[model samples]
Target chain A: MSFLKYRLRMDKNVHLIMKILTVFSIVTILAILLGLLYKAYPILKTHSLTNLLLSKDWFPQKELFGLFPFISSTFQVTGLAMFIAVPFCLLASIYLSEYASKSITRLVLPLIDILAGIPSVIFGIWGIILIVPFIRDYVAPFFGKVSSGYSILTGGIVLAVMLIPVMVNILLEVFNTVSRGYKEASLALGATKWQCIKHVLLIKSAPGIISAIALSLSRAFGETLAVLMVVGNVTKSPKSILDPAQPLPALIANNYGEMMSVDLYDSALLLASLVLFIIVLFFNIIARVILRRLEKNNH
Target chain B: MKFKAKFIEERIFKILMITSTSIILLSLGAILGSILYKGLPSLSWEMISQTPKGGFYLGKSGGILNAILGSFYIAFGATAIALLVSLPVALYINIYRKKFSKYSNLVRLCLDVLWGVPSIVYGALGFSVMLYIGLKTSLLAGIIIVGILIIPVMIRAMDEVIKTIPKGLVEASLALGSTKTETAFKIVVKQALPGIITAILLSFGRAIGDAASVMYTTGFTDNIPKSLLSQAATLPLAIMNLVSSPIVEVQNKAYASALILTFIILFLSIISRLLSIKYTKNKSH
Candidate 1:
C-alpha cells in the first residue's frame, strides 16, 4: 500500500512537469513575437510607418531607411513565381491524382520529396549557373530585351521551382480528398473525365487550393538565400522583369553584418524582419483557418 | 458540333496536364543533372579532409573540412536540444490532454505559426537575443537559434506519430496497473520510436542545410571551432561565400561543397525512410 502511494506521488510530479513544459510551447511563440517587437520598436518610434514603408531612398549611412523598393521587388518576384507555379502545380497534381496509375505516382512522389529536400542555397547556385544565363541570353533576347541575368525573372524562375513540390503536395492531398461518389455521380451523367474533374473535384477542393496558394506565397515571401543569389541586390524599384531588384529578405540578409555598426541600422533591419514575420504569421493563420474548415466539412 | 467541341476540349486539357507533369519531372532531372555535372569534377578526398588555407576564396588550394565538421557540430547540438524540448511537449499533448481538446488545439496552432515564421526572422530574433545577453556569434548561439527554429517541426512530426498509436494500446498499458507516465514512456514511445527517429533525422537535415538563421548567429570561421563559444562555419555559408569569388577554381569549389551537402541530405533522407519502414512493423494496427 505504501509503495502504491509512492508510485502515485511520482506520477503526479511527472504530470506537473509535463504540464509546465507544454505551457512553455505557448511561451516560446509569445517570446518570439514580443522580442522582435521590442527590438523593432525604436525604429517604429523614430520614423512614421508610412514614410519607412513608402519612400524609395534608403541611404542607411544618413539614417534614411525607405523600404518601398524592397517591398515592390518582393511582391513582383513572389507574384511572378506564383503565377508560374500555381497553374503548373495544379495541372501536375491533377495528372498525379486523377489520371496517373499507382506506379507513376510512386515514382513521382519521391522525386517531389527530393526536390523539396534540396537546399535553398543549392537552388541559388543552380539559378546562377543555369537560369540566370538562360534568361540573359535566350529568354530575354527573345523578348527583345537585354539583361545581365541577375534580374527578377531569374529569381522568379528559381523560386517557382522551389515552390513546385510544396504546392503539388498540398494540391494532391486536396484533390484526393474529394469523395469518389461525387466523381462517379458526375461520370454517370456521361461526362468525360476532364469534365468530371473540372466541375466536381475542382469545385469541391477550391478552399484547399486557396489555402495551398496562401501557404506557398508566405513561403516565397520569406525565402531569402535563393532569391538573394539570383535577384541582383539593386536597391532601385524594378520596372520590368529584366531589371535587377532587391527584396526585403535579401535586404536583411545582405546588410545584417554591417547593421550593428550603423546607427539605427540594426533597428531598421529588425523592423524589416518584423514586417516579414507579421505578414507570414497572417498568411499562416488564414491558411490554417481555411484548412481547418476544409477538414471539418470533409468530416 | 457541341460533342465535337467537348471532345476537343478534353484532348487539349489532357495534353496540357501531361506537358506540365513532364515539365516538372524534367526540371527535377535538370537540377540534379546540373549539380552533379558541375560538382563532381571538382570534388576530391582532399577537399573533404583539409581545412581551407590562406586566401581560400582567392583561388588558394584548400578544402572545406572546417565547414563540414562545423555543420555537423551545430546540427547535432541543435537536434539534441530540440528533441529534449519537443519530446516532452509532444508527449504532454497526447498523454495528458484529451484528444482534440481546446488546449491541445491551441498548442498545435502555436506550433503551426512558429513553423511558418521564416528562417530570416528567426535569425534576426537570435541576433537580437544575443545582443541582449551580450554574447558573440558562436556555435552555442547557432545551436540555440536553430533549436528554436526546429522545435515546431520536431514536435509536430512527433505529435502525429504519437497520435497514430491506437487508443487501445494506452488503455491496455494502464489496465496493467502502470501509471500514465509509465504507459507514455514504456508503451506509447516504444511504438512511436521509429517515427520519432525519422523526425529527428528530418529536422537534422533541415538544421544543417539552413543558412539564413545561422548566418548571423554563427559567424564564419576559417579553422575548425576549438570550442562551443568559437565562431563556426557552415556548409551553406561556405558555398555562398565561395560562389561570389571571381576565380574559376574557387567557383568550382562552391559546387563541390554543395555536392557534399546534397549527398549528406540524401543519405539522411534515405536512412530515415528505411528506418521508418523497417521499425514500423510492430505498431498497433
Candidate 2:
C-alpha cells in the first residue's frame, strides 16, 4: 500500500510540474502580446492610422511624426532588394532542383546554409567596406553627383545580398515539392529543357515563389543593420537610387538610444515599431493565404 | 536523331545549371573574402582579451573579453529560462491535443507575430518595462529581453520536434502499466532529444547574434558585469561602438571584434547544419 502511495505521489509531482510549466508558457506568450499592444497604443491613440501611415514628414525632433518617409524608404529598399534577389534566387533554385547533379547539390546547399548563418552585422561590415565605397566612387559619380552621402542604392544593394540566402532557401523547399511527373511529362512531350522549365515547372511553382518573395521582402523591410550602415540615415525623399534617405529601421535604431524627451522618443520608437509590425504582419498573412490557396488548388 | 537531340539538350541544361550554382558560390566567396581581408589584420590575442577604452585610434588597448563572457552568460541564462517555459507547454499541447489544441494554435500565431516583430521593437518594449520595474539598464534586463525574444523560436522548434515522436512509443510505455507522466517524461522526451538539441542550438545562435533588442536593455558598459543587474556589453554592441568611433586604431579593433562574432556565428551554424542533416537522415531511415 505504501509503495502504491509513493508511486501516486511521484505521478502527482510530475503532473504538478507540467501544469506549472504550461502556465508559465502561457504567461510568457501573453506578456509578448501585451508588450506589442502597449507599444502600439501610443501611436494608435495619437494619430489616425491612415494619416500616421501616409504622411511624409518623420520629424520626431519637432514632434511631427508622419511615417510616410520611413514607409516609402522601407518599400523602396525592399522593392529594390526583391528586384535583385528574385531572379538570382529563382535561377539558383532551378539549378539546385533541376539541373545540378546530386553531388553538386549536396555541396552547394550547405554553402547556401552557411551564407544564411552569417550574421547581419557581418553583412553590414561588408557593405561598409565594399558597397559603400563602390557606390560613392563609381555608381553615384555616374548619376551626376548626389549630395546626401550614403544613397538608397547602397542600402538596397546590401539588403539584396543579405536576403539572397533566405530567398534561395525558401524557394529551394518549394522547388523540391514540384511533382517529378510534371517534369517527366514535359520532357516526354518533346519540349526543350528550357521550354519545359519555363512553361511547366515555373507555372506550377509560381505561388510558392510568390510566397517566398513575400517572406523575403518582409525581412528586407525590417532589416536594420546593413541599412543603418549604408542608408546615410538622412531624412528625405530619395531622388535617385543614389540619394541619401532614412529607412524606418535605421531611424528607430539610431534615435531610440539618445532621444531626450520621453514622450517624443517613446512615441516615435513605438510608432515606427507599430508600422514595422503591421508591414510584417501583412506579408505573413499574405504568404499564408497564398500558400493555402496553392494547397487547395493542388488538392 | 531524337535520342541525340535529347542527350545534347540535357547536357546543355546541366551546363547552365552548374554555371548558375557557381555564381551563388562565387558571391559567397567574395563576401567572406572581403570580410576576412578587411578584418584579419587587426585580429589578435590582445584584441580578444581586453575591453574598449576611449575613442577610436587609441590602438588595441582593450579586448572583447568582457563582451565575450557576458554574451555567454546572457545567452545561456535566457536559453535555460525559455526552455523551462516552452517545453512543457509543447508537451501539454501535444499530449492533451483535444483538450488544449485550440490554445496551441493561438500560441503558434503569437509565436509567429513575435518572430516577425523587429528587434528594435523588442528593445523599446524591454526598455519601458524594465525601467518601469526598476531593473534599469542591466544584464538582468538584457537576459529577460533575450529570453522573451527567443521564446517563439524555442517553442516553434521544440513543438515541431515533440509532435513528431511516434504515438505508439508513448502507448507502448503506457501499456507496460506506466503512468501518463512516465510515458511523456521518460519515453517521449528521450525519443525527441535530438530535436530538442536542435531547438536549443537555434535559439542560442539567435541570442548570440542579437544586437538591437539587447542594446537598450543592457546599456553598454565597458566594465565586466559583477552582478546580474550590472550593465554589460556584448560583442555585437561592442562592435557597433567600435565602428561608430572615428579613431583608426579603434576601427581596427572593431574589425577584429566583428571577425570574432562572425566566426562564432559561423561555427554555430555549421554545427546546426550538421545536426539537422543527421536528424533528417535518421527520420528517413
Candidate 3:
C-alpha cells in the first residue's frame, strides 16, 4: 500500500504519461464529432430544420436538401434486417447452447468466424450476382410485376445475412451467461427441458440478448455497400418493400466521389454523415445501458 | 400423448435451429466458393506481378500488384499507428481497475460508440478534415481513417485480455517495490502476450478488408503509392471497380482480387483464433 502511495505521489513520469494517454479515447470521439459538425454546420445554418429533415425534395442545384426519404429508407431497411436477424439468431444460439454438443459447436464456430470476416464488398457482389438475379428472374415476377430486383427487400435480406454472425455470436455468449445451476434446478422441479429454457434461460438472457440486437441494429443501419449495390438508390422514399430507395450512408457514398464538382455538396454529404453518426450513437447508448445493467447484475 | 407432444415440439425446434445454422454455413460456402471458383483461374503471375495496363479495368490484361502492395503498406502502417495509442490506453484501463465506476463506464461506452461508427462515416469525416486542411487523397489520409477504425477494436481486445490477468500477481509485484510500469509491461503484458498478438492481427484483418473508408481518402491508382502523399488502390476497391465492368475479363480480375483478399483474411483469422485458443488453454490449467 505504501509502495502504491509512493508511485502515486512520486510524480512517476511513466504513470503520468499514461494517465494523459488514457484521455485519447475521449479525445478521438470529440475530434470526430467536431470534424463532422464543423462541416455540417454550414448546411445546417442555411437550411430550416423542417426543410432539411422532413421534406423529401433532394434537388441539390437549387440548394434543396431535405432528407426525409433517405432517413425513412435508412430505418426501413435496418428495421426489416433486424426483424429477420434477431429471431433467427436467437434460435441458432439456443440450439448451440442447449442442444448441440461440443463437437458440433467446434465445427460451426469457425464457419461463423469466416462469415464475420468476409468483406462487405464481397457481400455486395454476392448480393448482386446471387440474390439480385433470383429476385429479378423469379421472386419479383411472382406477383406479375416488372423489377430490376434492386429494392428495400433485397437490401434488407442482404443486410440480414451480414448481421447473422454478429448477432449469433453475442447472443450465444449471453445465453452462456445463464448459470448452469438454474437449469439443473428447473429440471429437478420436474420441468421439461423446454420449460427450463423458456422460463430460466430466456428470462435470464433477455437483457444481453436485447443489447446484442441493438448493437446489430446499429451495424445494419450503418452498412453502405451491400445495401447500396442492391437497393437501386432512387431518391424517393420506398412505398413498399420491393421499391428501391436511398438511405443516408448510400447517398453520401454514391455522391462523395463526385462531390468535389458540386457547390455545397461536400457539406450536404457531411450533414448526412452527421445524421448517420447520431443515429448509430443513439443505438450504441441504449446498448451500453443494457450491458451496464447486466454487468451490475453479475456483480 | 403428453410426452409424445413434448417430444415432437423439441424435435421441431431442434430442426429449426440446425436449419438456421445451415443457412449461415451455406452463405459462407457460396460466397467463398463462387469467388474462388471464378477467381482462381484468373490469378496469374502476370496478374499479380505488375501494375494495370491501358484499359486494364475495361477487360484488358494487367496486374493487381499495385493494390496488393498498397494494401500491405496501408494496413501495416495503420495497425502500427493504432498500436501506439491503443496499448497505453488498454494498459491504463486495466491497471486502474474502477470495475464499474461511472468514469470507467463512460470510457467503455465511448469506445463502443466509436467501434460502431460505420467506416463510411469515418471516410466522410476524414474527407471533410482533408478538405479543411487541403490534403488530397493519399496514403496518409487512408492510414488516418483506417487507424481510427482499428484503434477501438485493438483497445477493447487487449483490454479484455489484460483484465483476465490475476490481480494478485500485479499487487504482489507492487508490494515487492516493482514500479507500476514495470509490473504492467514486464509481468502483465508478458503474461498477456498471446492475447496481444491476436488483437494486433485481428485488427489487421479488419483494416485490410475495409474499402469504404479508403475509397475516397486513398484515391485509386494503377501504381503503388510511392510516398505518404501518393494515392493508392486497395484490393477491396479494386474488386469493387472491376466487378461491375461490362468486360468479362475485368470481372475475372475482380474475382482474383477477392480470392487473395479472402486468403489473407483466412490466414489472419486462423492464426488469431489459434493464439487465443492456446492462451485460453494455458490459462485454464
Among these predicted structures, which one has the highest TM-score? 1
DockQ of the candidate models in sequence: 0.74, 0.47, 0.65
Per-residue lDDT of A1-299 in model 1, one digit per residue for the tens?
A: 99999989988998988888778877887888888788889888999999999999999999999999999999999999999999999999999999989999988888898888888998999898899889999988999998999999999999999999989998998887888999999999999999999999999999999999999999999999999999999999898999999999999999998876788899899889988888888888898888877866776
DockQ of 1: 0.74
Top candidate by lDDT: 1
Q: After superposition, how far is residue A168 of candidate 1 from its true place, in Å?
A: 1.3
Query: Which of candidates 2 and 3 reaches a greater DockQ?
Result: 3
TM-scores for all candidates: the values are 0.97, 0.89, 0.95
The runs of at least 3 residues in candidate 2 whose Cα sits more than 4 Å from the true structure, single-residue gaps closed, are A1-47, A146-149, A292-299, B1-20, B53-57, B98-109, B276-285
Candidate 3: true contacts recovered, fraction: 0.66
Count clashing residue pairs per candidate.
0, 8, 0
Where model 1 places Cα greater than 4 Å from the true spot, the runs are: B1-3, B279-285
Residue B201 error, candidate 1, Å: 0.9
**In candidate 3, which residue ranges exceed 4 Å CA deviation?**
A1-11, B1-4, B97-102
Give the least accurate 10-residue stretch of model 2 chain A, judged by summed lDDT: A24-33
Summing lDDT over every window of 10 consecutive residues in candidate 1 chain A, give the lowest-scoring window.
Answer: A290-299
Interface RMSD after interface superposition, model 3: 2.1
Candidate closer to the true structure by lDDT (higher is better), 1 or 2: 1
